[model samples]
Every structure is written in structure tokens, then in C-alpha cells.
Target: MGRWTGWVRWGALGAAVVVLVVFLVAQRQSIDVSYGRSPSSSGTVEEGSAGELSDATVPSVDEMTAMVAADPVVRLPGSIAHWDEGLVRNAIGDADVRILVAPPGLDKDERGRVRDVDNAQLRVLGTEVTGSIYQAAADDLPSWRAQFATGDVTSLLVTLIAGIRDQDTPEDVDLFRWRPPTEAETAAIATDLRATGVHIADGATLTDIPKSAGPAFPDGGALYAAFPQQTFGEPVPEYGPTLAALFPGKPIVVIYGSWIEYHGPNAADFTDVVGASFYGQAADRISTYDYPQANVLHAYLNRVTDVRYAGLFERPLPYLPLDPLRVALPALPWLFAGCVVVFLALSARSLLGPRRGVRSTGPPARLAGLTALAIEMSGLTDEKSDPALTRGITKLRAAGDALEQNLPDGHVGKLLDDAEAELDDTAWTLGRNDYRPFTYLRGRLA
Candidate 1:
């Protein structure tokens, strides 16, 4: 086809796609849907009135242990505690492996604080996360940070744990961590590290572990977040499926951006902390543990039978600008619509497909195996065999080469080559039968 004709057809299709996009944009403006909570509190309800309506006191590690004991099988992540309490406690049967990742540490810059405030304001100490977990405690952050700085406080907390449920996949696990710790703030950093069981550097004193140079570990601990498929040092966005693929039937543990919490017990405010969802569907999967949860990470060697969302560090992967379709289209139905359009456009382009570029303007070329027998068994060449015969011969020679590579040891390949050679000879003979007629197609081609 001419270039002008191709452009005209393409322009028409382009206009249609634009119309669809515009219609979707307008439709999106009319309604909005999001995976989790909007940062705004203008219209939101409180989540997690689970357990009891008792006083909301910060839980102690011992109390956290008792709570875990209540379960039939408390599955832990390699990122949790250093050992499997299930094997240590309840290992007979009914072991439900509830996978989880390390919780996030709190760290937000002005850009993050501004984004949440001007947009959703969903961050810790900035908006609803503050209101939900520590509406009462947030006011005392300075005191807490100071208490943390004291270096004398044995245990510390921000009191942000609450009811988490899933709005998307109920089976999906959820996690929330809006805070982290500096070396001194933990006070018992040595004990905490031991709980995670990450090896302390050999020949190094406890003072060497947190003396500012970095944790003096020998080869890093077993709790070092062993990859279910530890191909990526930090959890990356694209690693979700790759992790799933590697683990197969086991669950998926996602640590958004591999936040700071992976290094130690503490850090601060992150953007996509999973537990912030008052409405995030996966809230029911949220699990909390005292510092002892490090055993979960220890289970990484067991192939991580459970999957979890640990917002440790809470630093979300850089928010990918949502696709125009995901943000605005009638996606589900639009999928069918898109398929229909694509099929039609392809079909139209095919049926009306340009003819000049056609490799052969005739019936399919002959299979080499059939050619030799056909040449010997039938009219070797008709009066008009030149063009068709030439094309078929060319195709047969190609098939022979393809056959050689594809079936080097096979008997069929040898047969195919032999047949092709016979056919080519017959075709050559026929093609040589020429006529003088200038206009007769058979003679003209010859």
C-alpha cells in the first residue's frame, strides 16, 4: 500500500484510541478508587477494635510471647526471631506458617511530609497513622525521643500497633512499622541483636557491635533476611513475582524498598507502611511480636513458607506514576473492550494487509519432504511451473537447512533433504521448458 493510505488508516485508529482515553479520563474524575487509605482524614473511620476494648497499653516482649502462645501454630519469618518457636513449642501438626517481614523504621524528609500533607497526609506523626496508633502518644514524641536518648530506658515503644485487615486479598499478610531506633535509643541493642541471632562479629566485644563502625558481625547472622531467593540485596518492586516464582507455593514476603529496619531494630516514618491502612484489605494478616520476632528472619533458610508485608523502614519504592489505564479506565470491562479493538484493528490491517511485501504471492511453498516424491510421482513440471516451481525450490532449500539444525540425528531430516534435492532437479528441468510468447504468462515468466 501507498504511505498515504497507511497514514490515513493509522490516523483514524489513533483518533479512536484518543477518544477512549478521554472518555476514561472524564470517568475517572467522576469517581475514585484506591488500594489503601487516602492520607486525608476528611472522611475516614478508625480500624482495629479487635481483641478487647481494654486499656491500650504498650505490650511487653513477654506479653507478646504469651499472645503468640495462644495460637495453634505460630509461624515465624526468617526475619522475625532467630529460632522456630513452633518447632520449639508446637510442632506436631496444624502449623500455619504466617509469613512476615521485618517492620519499617521511621524516617521521612520534607518531601515525604509535604506529599502526605498536601496530598493524603497519611504519614506517621503527620496524620492518621499518628491519630490511629498514637493519637495520644504522638504529642509526646519529643519526650519519647528524649527517653530513647536517655540510654537508660530498658524497653521503648510508640504504641502504633492496631487492627489491620485486607481489602484486596484477604490471604495477603500485612505489617506496620512507623518507627525505628538509633544505636543508643535501643539501650539493649546487644540483647536485641542476639534475639535476631544475626551473628555478632567474631573476636569482637559487645562494644564493637554498635561502636559506630557498623555491626561487627562475622558473616552476618542467619537472621540476615536470607532471600527466599536472596538474589536482590534489598527488596525491589519487580522482585515480587520473582520471589513468588522462586518460593512457589510458599507465601510472599515484601519489604518495600528494603528500608532501614532491615539493619537494626529502629528507623522512622516511611510512605507505604502496610499497617497504615484503616481500609487496606489485608489488615487481618498483620502480626506483631516483641523484639523476639527476629526468629521469622531466621526461618529464611526453610524457604519462607509464609509471605508477609513488612514495612520495616517503610520507605516505599519510588512511587511509579500509575498507568493512565490503571488510574482512570473502566479497567475490567475495558480489558474486554481493548481486546476487541485490538483484534479488530489487527484483523482489518491483516485482511487489508499490504501485498507488495508478501514473501510469496501464491499458495504456501512446498514442504521439502513432499517435494521429491511429488516431483517423481506427478507431472514433473506443467507449462506454467517456472515461477511457482522456483519459489517452491527456494523454500525447500531453506527447509533443508532448518531441518539439519533442528534434527541433526533424526532420520526424517535426511529424508527431507533427499526429497528436496529431487524436487529441485525436476523444477529446474521444467523451468528450462521455455516458449517465445511475449504475453502468455507461462512463457513470459520462463
Candidate 2:
């Protein structure tokens, strides 16, 4: 009985330990899908309000210009040339700003421009550059947009190619002899531009211009003024299941540039930072001298500086909901460890606990053998007058009574009852002079 009880206790403890191990292993292998919030608010933007540039406390153009001209210019080979630095400095005067000259064709070579901006000592708020209007009108807009998107600035330059002459020789061209982009083309281009997060500037210029060309474009100033006040009515496209799977819920913002005619109708809707272009007859001459024209750079600086100084670039962080499973997953390891500790403590106690020795209540096993021996020895004597046989039977019956009172109620007790019955039968056979029972009993005992 004692041995059986010990086995049962050990089996239960072993089972508990197995369960704890399984739980700990499962927790260690579980997947978590939640993400934490970003510390900086720079790249993060809220949903549905991606392109909003509203701020009542925006600085004026003069204030923005002063702020922008303070910083040194970061120039690239393909960017506005070194010769044109004086023109840019003259326009910005002594304000703080970092200007990066990144042309469309110079993909990775533009790294120096970025580094220069980073090295500047001023409060470099943002960067503005003139991209090729021709390249943007073509399919190269995506790559250009990608380059600007990776920059620290929130906006970029989107030059317009509509109504601009593409003549190779500046002298033989007519400025008025140009065609505007159709409404369909403009809408399609606008959609694509928005997808790339490119910021557009109004008042584009002709591809070819002589040094004599002045700021004679009719819509140049009006386009610039209307840029900040224009709002787009087109709905942004859904990212779809494939993009969602790839990026989850990543944010996208598009910058737009348009002529006064194109965005004038919605000008009142956009009451935020506006972008205007200074590239026309007067500005084109300075930029055409194997370098980005000074007047064009100045105009870009003025507009971009205004936007930056007005605090329109900083956007709020997108709100991401906490995932319940992800939050709970982290606690699993701790819980598992605690359960294992408890199980081990319990097992240790059971193994090292003081044990109570079990005592037997039934007659000793050797007594049964002795009783059988006595019966066999008496069998040789005559049954009618055998006093030894009578005494042996009486002793066996007394042993049976003691076993019935003291033995546990199980297999051992049943064996005791059977032995007592056999003893009575032996006595009866001896009394009747039937020697067969005694003979069988003696052989079984032997």
C-alpha cells in the first residue's frame, strides 16, 4: 500500500512538470504583430489629412526670405552651378536655409548635396531644387519623386512643361506659339505626382531661352500666388490589398504645381503655404548660363522658405491602435516562468518531505506457511483420535479471526478467508477417515 501511494504522488508531480514545460515552449515560439510608436514626428502623418498645410501664424514672404538666406548653399555638379551662387545669395541675403541643387538625372551622385545640407551651421529648415520640367512630363517623374521623398524636407519642386517651347535654338522660337496640357493629361499627371509625394511649383518656363529673355510670361506671378491657395479635389487612390500586405498602413503625400488657370478655381479652398516660380524671361537668362539661373533659384528660395518658416512641413504622427494579442504575448514568458518555478518547488517539497513509515495490520506472511506445515504433519495420525490435528485447526481458526479484524479490505483479506475455509475442510476430512484431503493439502504445501 505504501509503495502504491508513493508511485501515485510521483506520477502527479511528473505530469505537472510536463504541462509547465509545454506551456513555456509554446510561449517562446508565439508570434507578435504589434508595433510601437515612433519617437520623432517628422515623417509620420495622419490619415485623410496628409497634405493639409494650414497654419494661421505663417511668416510673411520677407520674413521667410530672411530666414532662408541665412544658411549656406549645398551645391551639386548637376545642380545650379557655382557661378550662379552669387545670384542665389543676392536673393536670400543673410537668412538661414539649406538649398540642395538636385537635377533629375543625378540619382545617387546627389549624396554630396544632402551631406552639405546636414553640415550647415544654420537652422536649416528645408531644401528646394529645380527639376527638369521635361523629365517630369515624361515617365521619369516617379524616380524624381522618390529622390525628393527620401529627403528631410517635406516639399519639392514640380516644374510645369505646358506652353513651354522645346526649340533647340533660343533665337528662332516664339514664346506664344505653345500648347497647354489637356485636362485629361493634367489630371493623370496630378494623380501620379500625388502618388510620389512630389510638391509642385507654379509658373514653368520654356526649354530654350536666349540671354535676352526677360520675365515676360503672363501667368508667372499669378501662378505663384495661387499655388499656396490651391486645393486638389481628386480623391487619393486606395493602397489596395497587395500594397497593404507589403507596407501595412504606410502614409503617402503628394505635392502639386499648376498654372493660375489650372488651380485658380480652387484657390480659396487652399489657404496655406503657396509655392510660386520666378523662372521666366528675366530668370531664364541667368539659369541658362551652364548653371541653374539665379532668378529662378531666388524665386524657389522665397517660396520654399515661406512654406518652411510658416511651419507647414511638420505633420502629426499617425495613430496606430494597440494589438491585444501583441500586448499579451510579452507577458506569456513571465507567466510560464512563474508556473515552472511553482511546479519545481512543489516537486522538490514532495521529494524531500519527511516520509511516514507504513506498518502492516494483517498477520505475518510466514504464519500461513506454518499453519500449512502443522496440518500436513498431523495428517499421518489417525483422524478419529488425533489431538494434534484438533489443536492445529483451532490455532488456524484463531489466525483467520485476527486477519479478518486487522487486514485491509482488499486482495489480502480475500486470501485470508480462503485459507481459513481450506483449514476447516482438512479437519472435516481427517475426522471422517478420508486421507485424500490430507494428502492433497500436504503436497500443495510442499
Candidate 3:
């Protein structure tokens, strides 16, 4: 019985452990989010392809603010900042705005793409940039900021050379005069000019580039060009379509170069306009004036353009505590773990019996028989007794004591049989002269 009880206890404990382990394993944190895409999306701005815009209905800034405010996942260790739509509109006139919320510790790759696209949370509210050049511009803003911040180049010219249209070329062009180009500058210029399909005339100076390039600059700003400090291995693919859109013709030269022999006027106005139009003034800031979030939204849109439709997506239930106990939400997991341990302890106790004492050995029947025999032997003795019988009774009492103290089953049975035979003999001896045993027998004989 004791052995069986022990097995039950150990089995219950093992089962409880298994249950806890399975619960922990199954409860590993995970989330699922699905986004909408445009029909022409390729997840990136491919070469020679127009950009695709997502048709997903992104919530407004106010709506998103409320949603994010309510979410416990992003409510970690910081105060939530609210963005006013009217404030943004006042800053950047009727432009698109986007916001990206990603898991903490994840960052973008060198190509200006989210490292984990599937898990990225995106929201957009405004007109989408459908042109590939515009999309590329948005994507490259981050890279451009990094390059400029690191002092890779002093100045760059993003020239848009379109066929002279309704707007005529300016007569007094604030052209940055040029001197003899260094070997490096000349080589960089030649390589960069190929992208715009422009070739410099032999023995021609940089001042004459406007005429030589066969295209007129819009409103005729500065008719100067500088080779770009090539940061990436290849120019971003979006630049082609961007130039194509601004300039209806080819030979639209965009170049980057160091401040080589500063002898000419600073074309800051021309360069600043181009930079701001493509990359915002403050490229790093999340405010509407620069709106880096818009770029993020555009990037996400391109990736998901292939999604036929966007709709409500089911998310895993968040582990948020009740509002009253919001302060304890962070400790909720630990609390659950503690509860599981407590439950296991209780279950084990119930299965193994509440008391912690030794289990029964199941020898009650044998012990009871020995006790009854001892009582009967005592009863056989009285005040009227023979010395021999009394001596015999004393011997039986001594044997009974031996039986009570750890006697083997075979030995106990033999002792018991001997005691029974003796008791019968004693009864016969005591009752021999008594008429009670032979009353009917004596009457029949008469």
C-alpha cells in the first residue's frame, strides 16, 4: 500500500511539471500584422519601372495617436507624444504624412529598407508618391543625411535638364565659374554624366554646360554642375525617373563633388531648392516640415503594392493588465508563473494525501487477531484456579508477547495453532465434572 501511494505522488508531480513547461513554451510572445499594397508594387523601386502606391486606408494622425496610446506594447518606459494634424498641415502645405512603428532594437539596412518588413508597422495619410523617382527620393533621404552629416562632400548639383518648354531659360544665369578640373574631379564627372546621357564637349569649360547639355534649366537658376561624391556603388534607381519627370528630355545632369578651388559664386539657392524638394531640409527630424515618417510610409507602400487588398488583421491578444492594475502589468508574467507553481503544489498535496506522516503498512487484520487471542487467554484465568493451569496460562501469555513483536507469518501461524490446541485441552479439563457439557448425554443413558 505504501509503495502504491508513493508512485501516485511522484506521478502527480511529474504531470504538474509537464503542464507548466508546456504552458511556458506555448506562451512565447508573438504578433501578426498585415498591410495593404498597390497593384504595381514590387516591394522596391525597380530600375526603369514607375513607382507603385499602396491603396491601404491609413488612419489619420489623431486616430493613430489614440490607437498607439492604447497599445501596451509601445507603452514602455516613455511618455507618448501627440502630433496635431493642423500643426503638420500648417508646416508642410497639403503634403503626405506617414508614421512607422517597429519593434524596439530593430533598425534599417544600408539600402534604406526596413530590416524586418513583415513585422514593420506602417501608417500613411496623404497622396502617395506614384512616380519611381519620387519614391526613390523619399527612400534616399536617410542615406543622403548620413553622407552629408559625415562630411563626404561639400556641395552637389541635382540638375533637371528638360527641353525648353513654356518657361524660357534665364539670360543672367548665376553660374558658378569653373577652373581647370583635377584628374579625380574630371574622372568622376565623366562617369556621372553617363547617367544623364550627357557628354562634355572637347576643350569646353564648365560655364558652357547649359548650352552643351542641349537642355534648358527650369526658370534658369545656376547653369553649373559639380560631380557628386559617389557614396553608394551605384546611383539610386529612382533618380532616373525623377529627372525624367522634371525634365521631359534626357541629359539631365546630377553630380557630386568636393569644394574644388572655390572661385565661383555659391549656388546655395539652386542646390538648396533641389535638396529640399527631394530630401527635406531637416532630413532626420520626424516633424511635418521634413516629415521623415512620410518617406517611411512610402517605402512600406512600395513593398505592399502587390497586396490585392488591405483589411482588418487579427493580432495576438496583448498581455495587458486591467486599468486598475495597470501599474502591475509589467509583473503580470511573473505573477502567472507563481500561480502555476502554487497550483502544482496544491495538486500534489491532494494526490499524495494531506498529512505528511508515514502511510499504512496494512497489517491491521493480523494485529487485531493477536489482540483478541491475548484477551481470551486473560479471561481464562480467575480467583479460583489450579497452580498447573495458572502456570500454563502464564506460558501462553509469554508466547503471545513474542507473537506481538515482529514474528514472521509462518512462525505466527504455527504459534497460533499451538495456542488453540492448548486452549481446547484446558477447556476439556476444566469442564470434565461440570454437568453442563453432558446433561443431555447423562439423561439418555438413564
Candidate 4:
């Protein structure tokens, strides 16, 4: 009985261990951390092919803004500072937009500029230029300043970029005399931009800027060629058509090295128009202008443009809160170890603890008697005159009789009676010098 009880206990423990192992293996499989890394900071720009502008009617800035705001994903360039709190609110409206910020490399003075922002529907990831913003969305990992709301980070990136650019440049250049990036430089910049996850239609420079109400700039200058109109801040209708053709269906970002007034009448036609100028003027305009910095003409242009082109890239996935299972995973091994220790302790206690005396019962006594009878019957010799054989037979008969009497008066009693009868017959056969019956009875008893 004790041996059977031990088997049952061990069987249950083994089953539990198997279940724990299976669960642990499943948990390990479910854990995935295969996020892609940022592209290397190599590659030079070399000009390639150019395409003709399509006559597709460009959406107005308001229309483009609405469209971008309605999209599931919107990718914007520049830091959080370029975005206005109210504009972000209006753009995102009721829907949740996960705003990821990958600022340029920071200097000591620019570090605090990327501080956490406040917005409930938005999650801000502080400056991580090498980190893939798309990966952050795809993996659903927590952001750097995940606690801050979207509004809290408003203009933070813009301000930081502006300040950093200002610090880097000792003097400002004349916008008219500024030398445009060469074809090779444009190609290299395009390559760098592509690494940041923005899709560049092709590595080509604008061959021509169609007719518009602006002065004609030198042709073959990638961005400058698109803006054939006078360098003075004015809407160049040709700019839109030229850009539309050069980079069809993609959001156009007009990046300028320094602050320049690029906003014009058809400015909204582009996805986003950004330059160091937009960020530099954001702070001063905040007090001069009643609206948020993003709502301002140039800032609005930048915002609307970003929204319009947001579709070209993957929509950033919302930031997922810290998982309870993930939090517990680190401690799971310790927990399992503790469980094993407890199990071992209990097993040891069971093995070493005081044992209770087993009371002798009728069934066990009868079983023992049966075993003794079988042994005595096997020892009987094939000699009828042998006194020792007679004594053994007598002992077997006594044991069988005692077992039969102790057994209950049911099927058990019947089976015992039959066995006793068989034993007696075997004893009689042995006495008559017939050993076959004795051997058969001994086999049956075994």
C-alpha cells in the first residue's frame, strides 16, 4: 500500500514538472526581439534619373492637411519642436497618432531641448537618430518619454534643431547667393534620407522647372531647378508641377541648409516644406502670432506636407505598455527555482519524516498465508514415506484453512475455497507419488 502510494505521488509530481517545462518553452517562443537597426552613416549621393511632371491636380494645403490628418500613419521630418500643440491636436483630432521623434545628433546645449512633452493621445520618443522610427512602431516597444503626452513635446525638436544649427554656423549666408547642393551632393543626401526611412522616388535632379509667374533660376539644380520663380519668397506654380513630376505621389520635403522664407501661395501643394528657418522663427513668432507655431504659414506648410507624404512609409505602430508577462519573465527562473526547492523540501520531508505503523488487516494476512502455503507445497518431496514432506503438507493445509476462514463469505471466499481445494489435491497427489499436480498447483499459487 505504501509503495503504491509513493508511485502515485511521484507520478503526479512528474506530470506537474512536464507541464511547467512545456509552459516555459511556450513562453520563450512567444518572446520576439528582432527589431531592425538604423542604416550605416555611409554612402555618397550621385545624381541619377529624372521624370517629367504629371498634370495631376495638386491638393490645396487645407485639403492636404485634412487628408494627412485622416490617414492612419503620418511621417514627419524635423524634431518635435516643428509641430504645434494645437496643430497636432487638430491633425490627430480624436484618433491616436504615435509621434516618433528621431532628432539629429545632439550637442551639450541641445540635450535638454528634447525633454518630455505632454499629450495624452501621443507618445514621444526622444532623440535616437540611429534608431529606426518605423521599428519602434512595428515592435510596439515603449518610448523614451512615453509618459509625456504629445502636446508636451511640441516644438521641442524644432527648437533644438534650430539652436544646434545656429550654434554650428558662425555666420548666416545670403539666400540668393547660397550655392545649391551639387548633383552628387543631392544624390548623397537622398541616400542619407532614404536610410531615415523616407522613400526617395529616384536619385535624380530636376531637369527643368515648367513655366510659372516667377524669375527663372539656373536649370539642372535639383531643388533650385524646381523653383524657377524668383528667389524672393513667392509661390511658384511651376514648383508644384515640377516636383509632382520629379517625385510623383511622394511627399516633397524642401530641405534648406539655413533659415529661408520658403512659404508661398502654393506651398501647401508640397507635403512639407522645412528649413532651419522654420525652427529658428518658431519661438519669435509664438509671441507675434496668435496661433500655434505649427499653424503659422511655413510651419503649416511643413506639417501639411508631412501628413501628405506620410503614406509613403510605414505607419508607426502605437507604443504598447509594459507587458506584465515581460516584467515577470526576468524573475521566472528564480520563481521556478524556488518552486523546485519547495518541491524537494516536501519530498525530503516525506522520505525522512516519522512513519505510521501499518495495522495488520485480514486481506493482507490471508495474502501472506497464501504465499506461505505456495512455498511449503513447492518444498514437498515425491516420497510418500517421507515424514518431512507430510509435515510440510500439514503446515500448508493449516495455512490454507486459516486463509479461507478469514476471507469474507462472497466471491473472495469462493476463490479462496477453490484455491485451498486445489492445494489439498496437490498435497494428496504428492503423497501418491504424482508430482505433476504439485508442480501445477505451485505454478498457480505463484
Candidate 5:
């Protein structure tokens, strides 16, 4: 039974360990995301790897006023903003927008923060349900904005963001260049993010968006007209693939970044592009364009050959939120092994039982019964008894002798016989101690 108990404990622990391992392995991708943020500030913002984006700027938002142009939907990230919270909220609530909470690290830097803020607002055109693709330029966002703008997006809105870095690195061609993304370019970006060990939404992928400042996605419309009162944060980094998956056919409205504030003192015609679609105080607040970061460098590269251009950066640092074991699967066997050891260590008490000394006396049941019998014999023998009795007593004892053979394992007969002999010798008188050893004798024999 003891050996059986040990095996049971070990088996239980082993099973638990295996179960934990399987659960963790299944969540590997989620775990990878928690580690996305880089501690120090030093990164690059290069040209994107997809479509040429610099050449396309057709009927900029400003130029298309009063025009009801409809065609097969274009791809774009979906988000909208408004100056007044009440207005933006009421409007987008019905139009197409489910605001998502910002991750902590995002709200910190206003510059980088704005891209996310503006991008979130784009949900009006409905990036939420339609998949918003996140594109970055270089390691930043110039590429996403630059190239995305080149593509026609009458239906989607893009979230452009960048993690923090020390230098813009503009002086070196290695730092920032204008380009578009090829099929290979897009695949490479997606692959790298995957290598980091993170799981993404079913249809989403990470593009590039560099870190930067306020109004990152500002439409020329009045603040209340487009963006809500909430401060801007980083936008999604992987929206292109997501959008394509969500609405296979739709126009994509590109509301990307321009360092120029759409509503600021020194704004550009592009601001009107942001404003054109984002009119109305309630549900129609469009998107904004304000840039401090860069867009997907790979997408930016692709934009070089695109018909139009729009680039921005806005993803928060450290993208996904999963535990370590769930993310890094290769390390699983060792971790589960450790857990098995811990489970075994805690089970020793139950496996060994009370005899182990640290606990109460859980001695064998048979041995305990014998000890009780010995105590009873010692007490009975202490009672006074006259051995120098008449012939009648002696004869009576002899008459019952044959019946004594049937006594049990720890019978008192042997002790009683010894005590009788001692008593017979003592006769007239004697202390109880004289017969005590006699009882001990019988006990030993038994």
C-alpha cells in the first residue's frame, strides 16, 4: 500500500505537469506579444517594402468636396475622430465604431500617442469590424502613410503607429527612404512579427508605424467634427491583411499622417481630404491626419509604385499580452519538469503517513492491541490473592487446567499460573510487587 501510495502521488503530479504544458503550448503566440516593447529608445524608420506610394494623390479630400463618388470599395484602416466627445461618441456609435481601450504604454508620449488616437477614430468608416491594417515606414510609419495613401481606400481606415526610438536617422539613406512593397515585402514584415513569437487576431498582421506626436491622424474638420476628446494613442500595426479579409470588396478611405496638423495653424490641402468624409457633429466625424511617427516601411516601399500615398505610425510598444510559458513553446519541457518536482515535494506527507515522526504515531493496529493487553494484565495481578489457600481451591484450579489450552494469542493464563505459584509460596501475606514480575513473565512468553 505504501509503495502504491508513492506511485499514485507521482502519477498525479506527472499528469498535472503534462496538462499545464499542453495549455501553455497552445497559447504561445499570445505570450510573445507581452515582450514587444523595447526598453531603450533607438530604432529606425525606413521605406516600406510594398507598392510605390509617393506618386498617388488623386482628388485629395479637399478637392473632392460636394462630390458623391462611388466605386468598388478601396482598402483603408477604419477610424474617425471629433473635437467634441459627445459628438464623436454619438455619431460613430451608430455609423461603425467600437472604441477599444488603449494599452498603458501608449498614453505616455503625446506624439506617438496621437497616431493611435487618430487611428482609433477611423472606426467610423469601420476599421473595427472591417480589419484595419497597421503599416509602418522603416521601423517607423512613413512607409504606411506614404504608401497607403497611394492606394485607393474609400472603405477602410488605417492605424499607423511606431514604438519609441532615439533618432529619426534622416541623414542616412539607410535611415529613411521612399519605396513600395512587393509581395515578398509584405510577407517579410508578417514573418518577422511572427518570429518574435506572438499570436495575432485571425485575420490581422503587423505592419510598420514609427513613434511620434499629437493629432497624428487629424482631418481638417473642426476638432469636434472628427476626433473625440480622448487623447490620441498608437494605432494598429497589422490592418492591411485584416481589412482584405473582412470586406473582400469595398472602397478604402485613406486617412493617414502628415506632420502637418489638419486643424492647426499651418495645415495642408490634405487636411481637407481628412475633413471631407468626416463631416457632421454626431455619427459622421471623419478621420484626422497629424504625424509624429512613421508608417510601415515595407508598405511604404510598395507605395512608391502605388497610385496615391498616405503614411503614419501608431502601434503601442509591446503589442500582445500573454504569459511567458504560453509564448515560448520551445522552453516547455523544462518548465513542466520543474512543476512536476514541486507537486511531488508537497505530497510526501500523505505518501509516508504518521509513522514518519514529523506527524502522530500511526503504528500498526495489531501492535497497539498487544500493548493494551499488557497494561490490563499488570493491573489485575496487583490485586491481593492468597496462595496458601485450602485443598479445595487448589483442586478447583487443577480441574479447569485442560480448558485453558484454548486461550487466545495474548492470553493471561501463563501470567496467572506464574502468579499462582508465587502466591502459593508466599501463603500468609505478601506485597502486590511480588506478583508483578510474574505477570511480566507470562506477557513475554505470550
Candidate 6:
């Protein structure tokens, strides 16, 4: 029983070791959990409040419609304009603009601050470069209306787009929420982006914008913003994945003769930073020469398109080279812990099993009898001898010669032990046979 118990314990121990090895390899291949939050906040929008609309601040759908219909240039809410000043200033440039904020109810503070200015829920409505007006707004208006309590603001947002669509504006409306970091939120965001295969250098500045909702053509397959005269670091391949990861379904806006600007951490060095773009002195030449007629880089939407929006989707989406460790993540550590415990328990059992002295190193004791048997039969011969028996006797003689070298205990020792058993059987058979002098034994005596 104890012998069987030892065997069971060793088997269990071997299984535990194998399990540990497999789990360790999985851990290495797994992506980091640090980038747990998705780069894009674009998702299902919540329903708007049904409470009475604020007559003082909230514009009725008709009023908003009329406002956009009357003029092409209008100022945005202070709360909204802060996202990206350049977006409203240069990108839009007095074109009729229509905006949509998710969870449509807009509340004003005593200081007139708009409280519902979240990046995930806000959208700027625009048409194609060919002057295609509010077509995008028409498609999304129903969804927007479903979220509103009155649908009046929805009408206003829709009408705003319709007005832009009717106008022959030369520029498309674009705006982003750009700001300098007053806290570590930006740094934490940058860290998260890095884990998703984005290469962010030390002291490099990072600012992100939410996905854009527009009907622009799929240019380079993504959307990015270009700030004037703001050339950032050298444009690395990581920028596409990083940007796509952040703004999954948006296009990367490119400005001719410009690059993104990065600043030092110090406030005095113009620490105000927002958006990402290619960097380096070479960027100056590239942007100036090659990008002058560049169209927007179109990207896949987080929900509307595949997750590999800007990624090299050589493999399945889940197996992205840098995919995060999301598989069995909550249970992996526990499994490893369990394996370790099992391994320890099995080790303990092995330690408690019967103790033995150091392994013997010389030839097995049975080698002497085997050698004697081989010598006695070496030169003996008989015409009626079985061919198999003759071969066996020859092999045994060779084993006997090899055994004299004092081979250390190991595989050689094990092989010699087998030889001994074979030789002993042969010797017993020979003793039972009617042997004749100077001849090998005949069959056992009948």
C-alpha cells in the first residue's frame, strides 16, 4: 500500500509541474491588464431626463434650428468649445455647425456651466466634403430622439445639420476637447495607451479626443486632429494603433503645413497640450510637402467596425499580438495558487516516503553469476541447438565482457540486471539438459 501511495504522489507531483509550466507560458503570452479601460467611450447612450426643460438655458429644437438657419458662424458653449479650440476655429471656419451631446438634457450651473459635457456622448454633425449636408444627422436623428424626453432638442440638432447640409460651406465642422493636464489623469491615460502597442516616449505629451460622428469618406481609415505649426515627435507606426485604440471609429484629421505640439511638464513652458500627431523636424517637411493635399485618415468605429480598426489584423481579432490578458484572468492567479499547493502537498508526501541510502555505484551483484553462465557456454556447440539460443548465448558473452569494466550504476546497470535474469534462465535449462562433453547442451532431458 505504501509503495502504491509513493507512486501516486510522484505522479501527482509530475502533473502539478506540468500544469505550472503551462500556466507560466500563458501568463507570458497574455496581454497586460493595465490597459483595462477601452480607449473609446463610444457606446450605447443613456436615455435623456424627462423633467421640465430649462426655458432660460435649454434651446428648444425649433429655436436651435432657426439659429443655425439664420447664420453660418455661431459660438459654442464655453463648456463645449474647450474640447478643441482649433477644431472650431480653423477646421470649421464659419461653416454652419450642428452639435449633439449625449443624454440630451443640458443643465446650467449658477455660473452658466454646461454640466453634460462628456467626451463619450458628444458628437459634431457634418456632411461630406462634396457639400453633402445633414445626411449623417438624418440617419442618427431617430436614435438621438429616442434618448430625448421632448424630442425638441433632437429636432434642433437635426435642423442644425439640415441647415449645414443646405449651405455650400467650404470647410467641414470639426471640434475636439483639448486641454492641459492639471492632474495625473492624462499620464494614466498615456500609460494605458502604451500597453495597447502605442509607443509613448518619456516626457512626451498625450491628449485624446473621443470618436467623431461624421459622414466623411473613409480616407486613410481613421480620424485625427491637426493643430497648426505644432509638429510633435517623429511619426511612428504605433501612432495608428494608439490613435485607433483611443478613438476607435474616428478619422485622424490632418492639417497641411502643421504637426502636433508637445510641451514640457512645467506650466511655464506652455504645458497646455491636446491631441496627437507625427513628430520630428522631418515632420515639418513631410507635412509641408506630402500632406498638403492629404485627406482624412478613416478608422473603424469601436462598435460599428471591427476591433482591428487600425491594427494589422494578420491574425484573429482576439489573438491580436498585443491583445490584453482578458482570458480566464480572474481565475488564473487562483489556478496557479492551487497548482502550487498541490505541488507542495505532493512534495511533502514524497519527503515522508521511505528513506533510502545513497544509490549503489558498482555493477549489480547478479553480474557475477551471469558472467559465469556466459563463460561456460562460450565455446560449446551442438548441431541440434536452437538458432535463437545460440544468438542469446553470444549476446550474453558480450555482456559478460562489458560487465567486467565496473560500469557505474545507471542505464548500464539496469541493462546488466536484465541480462542476468536471461542468463540464469538459460543456465537452469542447461542443467536440466543431457549435456555431452565439449558440446553445448541438448534439449532438457525428456
Find the candidate with the highest lDDT and give its number: 4
Evaluate all candidate structures by whole-model CA lDDT and list the values in order: 0.29, 0.33, 0.32, 0.34, 0.30, 0.33
Best by TM-score: 2
Q: Candidate 4 residues 1-446, lDDT tens each?
A: 12333454566566557656755774754543322221112232221111111122222335434544565333333332223445435434454443434223233223232222212123233222211122111111011111111212233332233333333312221112233445564555455434542222242222222222011111112232121112232222222233434444443433221122322223443222332323433432222112211123334243333332332223232234677765766666665566566567556735553221122334344445544555665666445324433443454455456555764534443444344434433454455422323344344444
- TM-score for each model: 0.19, 0.24, 0.20, 0.22, 0.20, 0.22
Tell me how far candidate 2 lies from the true structure as C-alpha RMSD in angstroms.
22.7
lDDT of 5 by residue, 1-446 (tens): 12334565677687767867586658645443222332222234332222212221222232222121221112222232212244334333344343332111111132133233332322222111122443222222332232223221211222221111222322211112223335654454345333542112222222323221112312212110111111233232333333233323322122232211122321234334433222211111111221221332222212221211222122223334676754656566666667577666647544432221111222222223323333443344322332222231343244244235544433433333333333322321234442333343344434
Runs off by more than 4 Å, candidate 2: 1-11, 24-74, 78-183, 186-366, 369-446
Tens digits of lDDT, candidate 2, 206-321: 12222221121111222211112112222222222222223323322122221111122222222223322322222222211222222233333344333323333342223458
**Candidate 3 Cα outliers beyond 4 Å, as residue runs:** 1-4, 35-136, 139-366, 369-446
RMSD of each: 23.9, 22.7, 25.9, 21.8, 23.2, 21.0
lDDT of 6 by residue, 1-446 (tens): 13333455566566557656666776665564322332433342232222212222434545544554554433334211112334333434454343433121233331123222221112421110112222222223222212111112233333343445454333322211123433353344445444542323333222343233222222334333332221221221223234434555433332212223222112122212122111211221221121211211111222212222323222122223544555655565676667567657756644543121122424433344334445565545343233323544555555556656655546455555444434433433345232221122111111
Candidate 3 C-alpha error for residue 38, in Å: 17
lDDT of 1 at 3: 32
Clashes of each: 53, 18, 9, 18, 153, 27
Worst 10 residues of 5 by lDDT: 220-229
Models sorted by TM-score, best on top: 2, 6, 4, 3, 5, 1
TM for candidate 5 is 0.20
Decoy 1 TM-score against native: 0.19
Which is superior by TM-score, 1 or 3? Answer: 3
